[model samples]
Target chain A: MNLLFILNKPPYSSDIGKESLDMALAHATFDDTVSLLFTGQGVWQLKTDQFAKLAGLKEFTRLYTGLDLYDIDQLFVSENALDTEQLTRDQLMVEASVLNDEAISRLINQQDRVFCL
Target chain B: MTTRFSILVTGSPFTSQAHHSAQCFVDALYSKGHQVTSVFLYGDGSYVANQLMHPANDESHPHQHWRELAQKHGFKLQACVSAAAKRGILSREDSELSGKSSFNVTSPYEIAGLGAWVEAVANSDKSLHFS
Candidate 1:
């Protein structure tokens, strides 16, 4: 199944985003085709050089670095989200392709299931 | 014709309407002769599984709605064990493992891994998320 996970919350300060990533990994481990879409402030999760330790929390964003290990290779980030944060693709921690609204709609249309977290 | 459904709850039990509203929706589905294969409580939504909740007699809280509905409909009510743990909702095994004095996960509501939700998703005709 083509399962897609849409994460709209930013990293740190909450466990919602972390659970979404873990659930995505679990789906992949079950042999389902899983993908991730980072939208809204969630795009901040892909920014490089996070200092979660400063917030007294573990750097859970590091999990994205190993998403590929679980066969979850498809990752996308919203263009407006990055622009709103004044971030560029080069500033992202991983190699997620920036997606505009039209592209995002297409991506959603192709998925058998899309989970918005 | 849709028959089997898989529900995901992602909102806080008391603070959010996910549980209460979802209970109504589940009943509506059953009224239409549909089957709920499973209801997976996740994120802050796991707070509903904390059966230790005690509301005053004059009012009702969101706990046990799923437990009762699942019993009537013969469906499974499960929660992500890790998420439930983070919110202080523990299963018997977890309570024992962590040496906690008590466990609050109510009967008919099981704490499970996310793989169980995945299985529900794969087996159901459709999946719905309440937040």
Candidate 2:
């Protein structure tokens, strides 16, 4: 099944963000088509040069590098959210397709299953 | 084909309306002859499984409602064990293992691993999350 995971939380601040990543990886491991969309504060999860280790938190953003190995390459980030946070593509750790509101809506509508976390 | 659903709750019971929203969604699904295969509670959402919860007579008890639903519909209601443990919501076995005097969770609301949540997602036709 095609699964779209919409993440809306910042990394390290809460376990939900990491758990959502785990969920996506698990689905992809089983050969399911998995996509991840970062919106709202979730855009912070992909920030470049994170030092969560200094804060005594698990560095889950490092796992994004391995997402491609798990066949979870459909990464998307909301353009509006990035703009709201004054972030740009160069600041992100991984390559993600920047999506506008309309594109995001279409992508969500095309999904067989959508999970917002 | 029967529309099989897997509900995921990631919000705390008292702090957020996610549990109530999940309950209403499940009720709607049942009324429409749909099946809810499982309800996976993660993060603070594990608090919903606390058997010690006792709300006032005027307030709606989401945990009690979930317990009743699990009993009536025979759907699996599981909370993430690690999350629950971190938040002090323990099952009988977990409580004993952790050397605790009492447990705050009971039957029909099992404390499980993330594998169980993944299994619920895999087995269902659709997965819905509330937070």
What is the alpha-carbon interface RMSD for each candidate? Answer: 0.7, 1.8
Model 2 lDDT tens row, B1-131: 57999999999898899999999999888888999878999878999899989999999999999999989888999998988898999999999999999999998999998778878887888888898
- Runs in model 2 with CA error above 4 Å? B97-101
* lDDT digits (tens) for residues A7-110 of candidate 1: 99988868878888989999999999999999998988888989999879988899899887899899999999888989899999899988999999999999
- lDDT of residue A26 for candidate 1: 91
Q: Rate residue A50 of model 1 by lDDT.
A: 90
What TM-score results for chain B when candidate 2 is compared with the true chain B? 0.97
Which window of 10 residues has the lowest lDDT sum in candidate 2 chain B? B113-122
Structure candidate 1, residue pairs in collision: none
- Candidate 2: CAPRI quality band: medium
* Cα RMSD of predicted structure 1: 1.1
